[model samples]
Target: MKRNLLILITAAALLISGCATGPTVTRTASDEVIDLSGRWNDTDSRLTAEAMVSSMLSGGWLERFSTDEGRPPVVIVGSVRNKSSEHIDAETFIKDIERELINSGRVTFVAAGAARDELRDEREDQQSNATQSTAAALAAETGADYMMQGVITSQTDAIQGKRATLYKVDMELIGLENNQKVWIDTKEIKKLVEQKKNSW
Candidate 1:
């Protein structure tokens, strides 16, 4: 009974100390602020966005828009192939590019098949007695002129008890009407970490 009482007292004291100190808040070692770190598999999405932006400008996509009588180009987020070992949300990257392009006022976003369905439904409801017809009804709904698609790949290498990770993201925009690829983009990002030794 005495030993049990002493053990309970020790446990209580340790718990009190732990509560007072609280848990440590670990911070990333590198000075560079990156997207959420850890073994997340969504790295390709970010890389894809970066590559598309660079390629769009370098591939003269904006020039094409200007040549088309200043009519903003329409883009649709298409399938982004995740060929990596892990699954990732590629739509997030597509959405990011779409958001940026729309905000730039140089491009217009064409709703995807799902969005088109909802838009048509809304237009039908308003067609009965509306003060004004929607833009969708006024003109032939222009389908997306360009579709964005991509693939993600990865590689792992180890040396001197350390491991390095490499990620390659490739994307392209193809003209829908003419079946010609208008833009091609690629981005690569890598990270390395050393293995930790066990403490004695």
Candidate 2:
């Protein structure tokens, strides 16, 4: 019947309209600061790295090490543990610090952790595949004079659609030879987020 066809067509149109389409995405600059969820993000990582680098390079540790060693102190970036509630990629923060240190020319950096394993594997591969002249010598890699390690912790409080988070990042530089802690620093970031209750 004509009435049945009309109902069927109306239902199909409503179902099609209710279906969700693809997401809308907008590109932004890499360095531009943006916070959507009030959680940790690239801006936080970048700012923390900048603050840490500034504090570390301006401290007396680098000078004392260079004075005693007669060369820039070699550094290896160790683990940066994330102890926060939310999942965070600590590698990005660690890489940022390493990049700054290398660019500053204040210290030399050597690979650590998995990266060291990869480098060693490549050296082993070269032992048999390449000529002696072109192959890198084993046990000739520079040893780190110091190790940099740190942890990131966070606390959150929420009540009545309002929430606040505090993040603390603690870092230290330790001498590999004597196990002396040369430098220590902490950076803190706080954010507040609020939501409104539906009035409908």
Candidate 3:
């Protein structure tokens, strides 16, 4: 009984100390560069997508397609396979790429995956619930001329208390009609993380 009582008292004291000296939390600007883990993060995803899409827009494929079709090519963001060892959210990356593509005004963006399915479901629902003029017509959806897909891969090297990580993202634009790879670009981010000795 005495040992159990001592253990309980010790645990309570540790918990109270933890609560008393807990870490600080504060809100900062969203775009602020904070690398707590030196892993793949939102900043990396957004910046990489912006750079790659900018390069893709300047590719010869865009000019070729424009000359042949006389319109901005309708593009869709396809899957970005995450083959990295670390758990990374690919949807956030995809959205980042889509935003850059749409904002650039160099291509027509089409809905894909869940968003596309929801749109179709709404269209079908409107057929019965909405007036004829208000209902979105069927077969009016724009087909994507090119599909952009990619893969995110990473490598890590560690020795003693030092570690280095390299992440690569490769994206390709493929002609939907012919399965031809029209453009490809790669972006890389490298970080060296050092574990500091406990100051206390």
lDDT winner: 3
By TM-score rank, best first, the candidates go 2, 3, 1
The digit string of per-residue lDDT tens for model 1 on 1-200 reads 99999999999999998879666887764434454432333444544565567567556776866697567677887776777655566667667666656666667778775677887887777776565644336446777778877787777776765666787778788889897888887788786756566211
Assess candidate 2 and give its lDDT: 0.92
Give per-residue lDDT, candidate 2, residue 199: 19
Give lDDT: candidate 2, residue 29.
96
Better of 1 and 3 by lDDT: 3
* Candidate 1 displacement at residue 61 in angstroms: 4.2
Model 3 residue 140 lDDT score? 96
Better of 2 and 3 by lDDT: 3
lDDT of 3 by residue, 1-200 (tens): 99999999999999998879666899999989889988999899889999999999999999988999999999999999999989999999999999999999989999999999999999999999999999999889999999999999999988777889999999999999999999998999999988876211
Candidate 2 wrongly placed segments (more than 4 Å):
1-20, 198-200
| TM per prediction | 0.68, 0.88, 0.87
Worst 10 residues of 1 by lDDT: 35-44
- Better model by lDDT, 1 or 2? 2
C-alpha lDDT of residue 77 in model 1: 73
Query: For every model in order, what is the number of clashing pairs?
Result: 0, 0, 0
Once superposed on the true structure, which residue ranges of model 3 sit more than 4 Å away at CA?
1-22, 197-200
Better of 2 and 3 by TM-score: 2
CA RMSD (A), model 1: 5.4
